[model samples]
Target: MLATYPIAATEQNWISATLLGALRISLETLQEGNAPPEFDEALSEEYREDFLRGPKFKKAYDLFIAKCRPLTVDQRAQVLTALNEQNNFPGVFTSTTPCCSIKDAFPDVHSAANELFKHAFEKLSEWKTPGCEQTIRAKYHQLVDAHLSHGSCPFCGYEPLEAADPDLVDPDLDHYLAVSIYPFAGVNLRNLTVMGDKCNRSYKGAQDILLDEHSARVDCFDPYGAEQVKLSLEGTRILSGPGEGPAWVIHFDPDIKSRNWRRVFKLETRLRANVLERHYKKWIEHFVSYAQRHGFDITSTDGAIDAVARFKETCEFDSYPAIGRLKTCFFELVEAALNDPMTVDRMRNFLVESA
Candidate 1:
């Protein structure tokens, strides 16, 4: 619980990588590494007869299968080990056009990959089916196991979030790079993470988390990295961005670099929910009451910031009000507001101060 917490990613992070590779092998076998639904039969009659129906497509597909197939246990380990590596797939597609190859009539990689996963996901529906079921079931069972063991959603650590692959068994794996924008990563293993429904569906639906120069390794919120997100508060609202903000009302950020993350995930709205607002207000109230009880002047901004800093120092990010990192950042707000007498009085008034 205390050592390496859910900063970078969960313990089951490797499950997606392995499954993705396994699925790709099976998926390609099903598709011949060609188009997903129906191959471009219209490309040419030669393609239609030979590649589509004749031995030509079968020949190419079989070659790819042989190339990727593992014969021995060591070969299997080597294949999986290679697959586990992050492709940085988005970066790999440096071409201006959307397609992987220009020769094909409809050479677009995005739609290709997207449809590939769409079919692959269906294949995952049951164990009886070859490609999809085994991997999807494994993902589901992992989530069920994690939830049962941890009690709290390991990803966000806030709500007693449920984990089930709703699309198959649950919708827990959020493509770190939303598959809609960067569909090339549709099957990329490291790109997917085990997330709660609230974090994945309710908040981050097609929003791109990888915009700007924000590297997923360094910036994105997963179970890896100790300091991926830095939270701060302006008044009662919590934010994560470039610097101490002039502040957004909840749906936005003043800084552009930080804005994409907040925008995609709707972090501002989630962080400033009424429940969290109450907790933030209560913290300010605690500080104010403590000052008043000792006849300490909060007008002394340094002292007030120091007090909040002390509280923040001992507080862990995963604890309640669930937005603890941002709550702790409210210490900065305390200091800023204390400098203005009106803001100070308003804060004091905001306090209920125990009967």
Candidate 2:
């Protein structure tokens, strides 16, 4: 669990402005007229500057921090109270009606509001010391394993009925942006979360749900006008900008399954071999062949072998993109085992080994 820092002076204003801007846009889109093109451009610029943490935003943040620190105790207390009030301001997409999931209720939004908050928060992760990574990851894992191993989704207070049985699932490094997209959030380490593979796979994706003109909707819950959280599972199965009702399992790929290798490889031995083999076979086959032709050990010393593995770890905040191409391969293997029915043994192997 990443410790959440309360929003300070500038961040509080940024979050409030971002949320208000998104609300304004969503309402404008719902009016009986065409949406202004400038709406998206303006929103994008705000997102780029505030949510993306660009240079201008950095300078502004420094000024805000400097001003906030010298506040008297009463002043600081007032800021803290305002931040807590913001929390109860009716979180966007809180509806749980059967015909309407949160996404279904909010249509016409460009992105998920919560995701914006998460991205903003993720910027803070860069300042954390080394122990923060392990601390957060371990806490996330503990919450997930408790539920998966015991038949629940602990973080959100959800549980799988025995009849549902989950067929297959694992603790996934989930961007809460996709699962429970909240506005004013920036998808930071604090907002990063864990969830069952089923929830991430079954419910979320890149589009807003269908909105009927007949049904009365709230501005905060509107998806089309809201800052949308684009869901990308398996690099496909995407819905965008007021399309589908919810995600349907439309595609599955075996090659991306890491647990497949687990069936044939132990944690230390076969896992590396299989990931390396997949990396060579899928991505760098041509380059590797050419390199071998020239007598260069590019596959070995070049770090291509562990590229995908490294990525898998870093996707959980372990490392950087410059290290290699490890994450893609590792993702594939994990996805493979997760989606494949026949790969139960492989999945089990992973659960035990990882545990």
Choose the strongest candidate by TM-score.
1
Q: How many backbone clashes does candidate 2 have?
A: 56
How many clashing residue pairs appear in each of the predictions shown? 16, 56
The sequence of per-residue lDDT tens digits that candidate 1 reaches over residues 187-244 is 4444555556887778767765644335332233333333234444444433223333
lDDT of 2 by residue, 1-355 (tens): 0011122211213343554454444334333244422323435464444434454333333333333344444543443333233333224324332222323333222133343444444443233223344233343344444433434332222323132223433245444433243333333333334543444455433222222133432232221122321112343221212433212221212222322211211222321343333332333343334334555432232333233233344343322221122334335554454445665344334333322
TM-score versus the correct structure, for each prediction: 0.47, 0.25
Global Cα RMSD, each model = 11.6, 20.5
Worst 10-residue lDDT window, candidate 1:
1-10
Once fitted onto the true fold, the runs of candidate 1 whose alpha carbons sit more than 4 angstroms away are: 1-115, 119-160, 163-171, 180-184, 207-227, 234-255, 274-278, 282-322, 335-355
Error of 1 at 128 (Å): 15
Model 2 CA deviation exceeding 4 Å by range: 1-138, 147-182, 188-193, 206-355
CA lDDT, every model vs. true structure: 0.44, 0.34
The candidate 2 region of ten consecutive residues with least summed lDDT is 1-10
